[model samples]
Target: MILILGGTTEGRIAASIVDEGEKTFYYSTKGNEQEIALKHGVRLAGALDKKELIRFCREKEIRLIIDAAHPFAKELHDTVYYAADELNTPVIRYERIYPKLDTDVDGIFQHLDYDGVMSSLREDKVRRLLTLTGVKSIAKLKPYWKEKGVQCYCRILDRDSSRELALKEEFPEENLVYDTPDESLDELLKRLRPEAVLIKESGISGGFLEKTAIIRQNKIPIYLVNRPQLKPSARTVDGEYGLRATIDEFLPQFFPLHTGISTGTCATAAARFAYAKILSPSPYVFIDKERIPVILPGGETIPVQIHSFSGSFSLRRIEATVSVRKNGGSDPDVTHGMLISATVSIEWDHTKEMRLLKEGELPEIIFHAGEGVGTVTLPGLGLEVGGPAINATPRKMIRENFEAVIERACVPIYSTPIHVTISVEGGKEIAARTFNPRLGIEGGISIIGTSGIVRPFSSEAFVNAIRKEMEVAQATGAPRIVINSGAKSERMVRNQYPDLPPQAFVHYGNFIGETIQIASELGIERVTLGVMIGKAVKLAEGHLDTHSKQVTMNREFLATLAHEAGCSDETVSAITQLTLARELWTLLTPSELTAFTSLLISRCAQHCQPLLPNGELTVLLISEEGVIYG
Candidate 1:
């Protein structure tokens, strides 16, 4: 659970961001203000003191705190820090972006603290002063003004509390200016005609710029009070996106939402459990005697369950097997609920064991493709031709897990040779639905996982894959790279560039922006983007993410492109009436098709040039019939 101390724009955005899966509570100090509507799982509550706040966090099981309150709310900020310290919880401060002061202007005084404001006022000996700071600090300034006999005017919110604060401070009714922040202070400034303006350094959202500009235009001296200095230990972010990123770091677990452990993670857990069982008495090495933690590639540790385990040991041989059910969550994957198993067998090898012991090294751990597991038969994949279809990430995971088990148990690995076989139940049938058949991974699905954890429908994972593939291509000393939308386009591109190595072709999967940006960053000399008409139209309109859910094909946009291509009104109308982008081919004549294709390719190139600033880009539009729009 998370708690957000919010009253400003940043607070509202933070609430929305953390409110998705976590139970978030938004705290506000103002009671009379209108309540802002929030999404599900976010509850709005009134303010609490330090002790009360600590009690609330404990009662609610809050583990993270996001402080997005006003910068001037020193009391509230202090309370949040104290409560977080007492609860031993993490706190992220969403600080506002302060506007740059115009130091070039004459007769402007800026102070880092409130004392500087008082010093400047005392030095100036100003008789009439106008304060744009809120009513909360009026009491502090009243003493100084009264001692100096300076007639002070203050602009505050038009609320009963604000008026009462001024009245109790003995500020005259005529000198009290009651208005909201957005309301212009022109009337009050003109009526008072003060020699200077006193204000706090509220950020842009707090009308700091507007107040400064108005005071400067009136030729009034400005005294700006800097915000209080916060603790250096507090993590501070300046924007809504930064706040979201901070919150994600604090609470890294994916919950009731659509997320899953990768197949590689499942295989690693099974292999590790099986290997651990061979060394330990129990089948699992429980963390704190509760659960087993499988560390993913990204350094995130997730608890996995061992569904079943069995082992047998003899005089010269040891055998163990473990199974873990794959959980794909909401990802549209074929192997969602399948069981993945790993069997480990070790035999005494005297000759090899003697050589290994002489060198003080462990014996080799061999891997095998068991039943329902595929074998690589292609040259493009980063594996031996006859090796198991487990990719490099999963292979590394398995080796790491095995080594971890050996190190934890101090097993005598130098005396034995081990072989581990990884298998998936019903994976061969599932491979037919994936790209394994076309990729030449015969018989079964590949044991593939890059991050070891699947964020359902994760665009980040797709974009990351494109980046990794581009990096691999760049590492191959390939001067040119081919970027495609999917496997079909990649195959078509391969036919076009037959001589180029397979590493030179990458499937972007609706991540055109990321692909181009990565290509430019990798300093590739040339890039060819092969896309279908549906995605091409979206790209032409500057929608880099061409996913249907992210951006729909704009019929009017297509019609406009057609009109620009010198099509007739009737033809344009027919194109607009068409439902799918591919339907336009049937509606257009040969000349119109040429014109439309030319315009689309031109538009795509125009939009892609900025992303490929240092590289050359070529756009290829493929039709429904596999015809290239050259």
Candidate 2:
């Protein structure tokens, strides 16, 4: 058994690349590790201390350990190293990929240490400091900025805590401390022009490329921070080559009986196989109508229809002008119907078998594992089911049309039938983001029409979805509803309640009161509210509606707390308004953080109790202390 300590994306990807047959374990400090692990069919272990780590490994009978923990998680890394040394198990620390600065930017400066950064900033004019750095480093800059009296603006993550931090710091309410870049940098520059920009070399997905574009457009001096270098003792790999080489080298060691097992070659061979099947001469027509038969590889059959197709090749640009007629006539005037021209696209992976779903006119490729297979539909070709439901009908027919013709068949017809991917010319790029992340639904949005017709509003559908999800959660035998605004809390909640399935936890997303009410209505016997500090204060103040628009900084209440604690109004307001419960604790010395966390937890408990008077309520507040209440 392989125990893989994974916190970073690289670790996840590395784990994903491991042999399909190997039993792999992926561990995370935060709670969502289980869902992720389950999705990929990997064994998951929650955040564990040094002793717990040893016990877990020994009990699980783990043979090898892979420490793919975040570069910054030194304690966890040390624990893994120590655990391996004691258990006498070999450990491989998968090195994380860091952002490599482009050679074009000349005046950009890079720093390793925070103190060094402070000193370096002090040397320059440093006016209008745009800390593209994370919120974790904000406190360090606060003391310096307070003394220096320099105008500083930090671009933190556009999260609730970051927003609250900005509000607490009194960093110009109108000029946001952090923002998501939907608009171009040129537009953003016009909004908040800065002389200098400080940014971390966060990898590709971290929006470093966009940051560079913004910086270059504005021609602002940049203070770039480099990632911590790996220790010399650790084995390392370059981008794709390292990952490929490691798997190749390790595969033979483990599977000596298996020959010709190259990861790259396998992927290529698989791609070829999928392509060959798609290009092969086969029956591609559907005969569903009686008496009058219509062949539709393109369009011109059904009136007002939805065609769903799935294949290896891209069909994003394969637009078909569809014309539909009633029964047996092609008279446009007699048909009295609608015409739709739409792009046909397919989502198929080379690694999986053909599993097509035929629901009326729509044909979808049912994904088994990571692969998609050819599944085509002609929306205009009215099938045996007659005219599809008005809402069930697609506006157009979309079928994958491969741009390239393959002459050579690499694999034999019976050689385990390796699947190959269809190279849909423009299909892949068009579906880049939608196909990869978010919405557990992978590949792309299913070409589905439930109502048969597109309606003006979809709010009722959303409510129905939530209701169904709630019912599903309740069915899982989770008595206590765990509603969290953060992903981490839900994970921790699951760890605490191993019997309770993950779906039971609802991500309320700033709808604390609404979630509570829903749980109460749904007959949830109890509820555990998990929240960070930013939302805690409002909850304490009986501002049940914690929406920022509904909440005003209760200056008087904060002033009173400050006076009771013997602090200034500014100090108290700042402390009270802090989104981070940990930071609020910092205002009070070492002894004070707990007191502060406790006070806030009490406030939250008091505010929450009456909302769900019938249910047993437990508000678990997580601050720097970690889980102050239960």
Candidate 3:
């Protein structure tokens, strides 16, 4: 068994990765301990305080403990070291990986503490200081303002919570700059040339290396404050490196192993249940709840919704109450069993929406509930309730994809769920680019996934979600919209329309029918579909099932196209699905390939007309011959 001393983002992320079948416990701080563990469905072994941790180790038979707590979580890190020694257990320090120095400038220095950092700077020469040390330590340097006579600035998370902290700490509002690594620091420095820059080693998040490099390029000195040293006996690793490396090594067991409860499997099951049955009907209910009224294909039942039937029937529903429980918690005093009763109403009817719903086996929902026991439950037939609120995964995926496209996308992400909550910014432009507006999911993007598993090479789910984006864009009065297949295409699309609202773009993988249907539904005026060759061809041929799992290269179709283009039959049949277009180009010279692309684009325009009868459709064939027939 492993107990992770978690608190920081890296710690939560690491804990989130903890798999079942392996004995692992996440020890959080007093208040957040239960919440963090529950969020990831990892066992919470109470705090990392000596007594609770030691007691938990002995009781749970914890063989190894991971100190993946915050870098500045000094006391907990120390306690784990001492407890491990006392219990004679292996203690691994899962450290955060910090970015290396990527700057070409000179005169930038790194130090161990604030005083050392302050002493090294050019006291009289420094005109402005950019502090990237977050908001916690802003007060420490305020006293120096009178003596140094240098204007100090700090970059922090652009959150209202962070803002509240800044106001409480009396941080200078003018100097309270927001942190964005991609933002042009050169422009910033040019506007306000500082003599020195003060910063903390905030690992990768602080953008330490990039910030330093930017400051150094302007001939400014950087006052790098080193992390504080823990106790000699504290279990330590190479900060972020150790944490990430350990998770990478141990995470596979949770997914593939059969022993112990598997969080991934459980979450996968839950997600499948939600998607297959719950998402369309009772999308409101969660894991650990009882007596959920969920509508299915036929009649409704107060019990459960069943997708598959073992009897001689097409599909069936049962009216039954469901209960959830947990096992193998750190607490030795209480026996584990069902923790909550969730009643679900399952019914069946032949609604077109029900028949057209996405179908696949669901993923399991796993989490640690009250105490340290892990819980895995599938709500395919019913509603699930209990466990900590986990809405960060969807947020992360959304932010990552959005930031990748916008280059400077800065939206505040809440670790918790905010249903019906309003996000003024996320609601404005970016939401139009997403499906949130259509789904009636207000505020920022929804934290999603039942099992927390992303299928390999599958874009069906993502594409299906774009219909919602179209609805949102239409509702927001976006006349001209750009739809791309993935992140790279979205980035390129954004570059093409720099002034367009971020919401005016959508990432629709291969669900050509769904996206176009949304366009038709919304009565869109114009649509620019950016596609890779394979998907465009699928769309050109009117294949609704564009999923890689469902469709493959039609050798006959390719051969026909090849023959029509005067290419050898062997050329079309021999090529892999992914490289078919490029391989088709190989049969012809450069000019012919360009002509073929144009032909494909022209065919695409013809094919899309049926999908968008009254609306204008522009097919942008993105390949070696950039923007072929837009």
Best by lDDT: 1
Better of 2 and 3 by TM-score: 3
Question: Which residue pairs in model 1 clash with each other?
Answer: none
Give the deviation of candidate 3 from the true structure as CA RMSD: 23.0
Instruction: Note the Cα lDDT for every prediction shown.
Output: 0.75, 0.48, 0.49
TM-score of each: 0.46, 0.37, 0.42
Writing each residue's lDDT as its tens digit, candidate 1 over 71-107 gives 9888888898888888789988887767555566644
Query: What are the clash counts of all predictions, listed in order?
Result: 0, 20, 60
* lDDT at position 304, candidate 1: 73
- Report the lDDT tens digits of candidate 2 across residue range 425-485: 2322333333222212223222232112121111333233344445556755766777776
Global fold similarity of model 1 (TM-score): 0.46
Q: lDDT tens string, model 3, 1-630?
A: 566666565555455435322333545543432233232234444445688778878988876676766666566777878888899886666555465443333455777777666666544466567776777767666666435466877777776767888888776788777756555778767866666777776666435567677776787766777776655543345432233333434444432211111122222222223322222333344444332222111111112222221111124332322222322122111212222222222344434224221222111223222222222222111123332222434223322222222222233221221111111212233334443343333333322332122222233434434654565455445668887775445655565666665456775655666777678777897998887776766655667546644665565665565556655445554532323343454455565566566766777677666788878877787763444345
Best by TM-score: 1
Name the weakest run of 10 consecutive residues (lDDT summed) in model 3.
Answer: 294-303
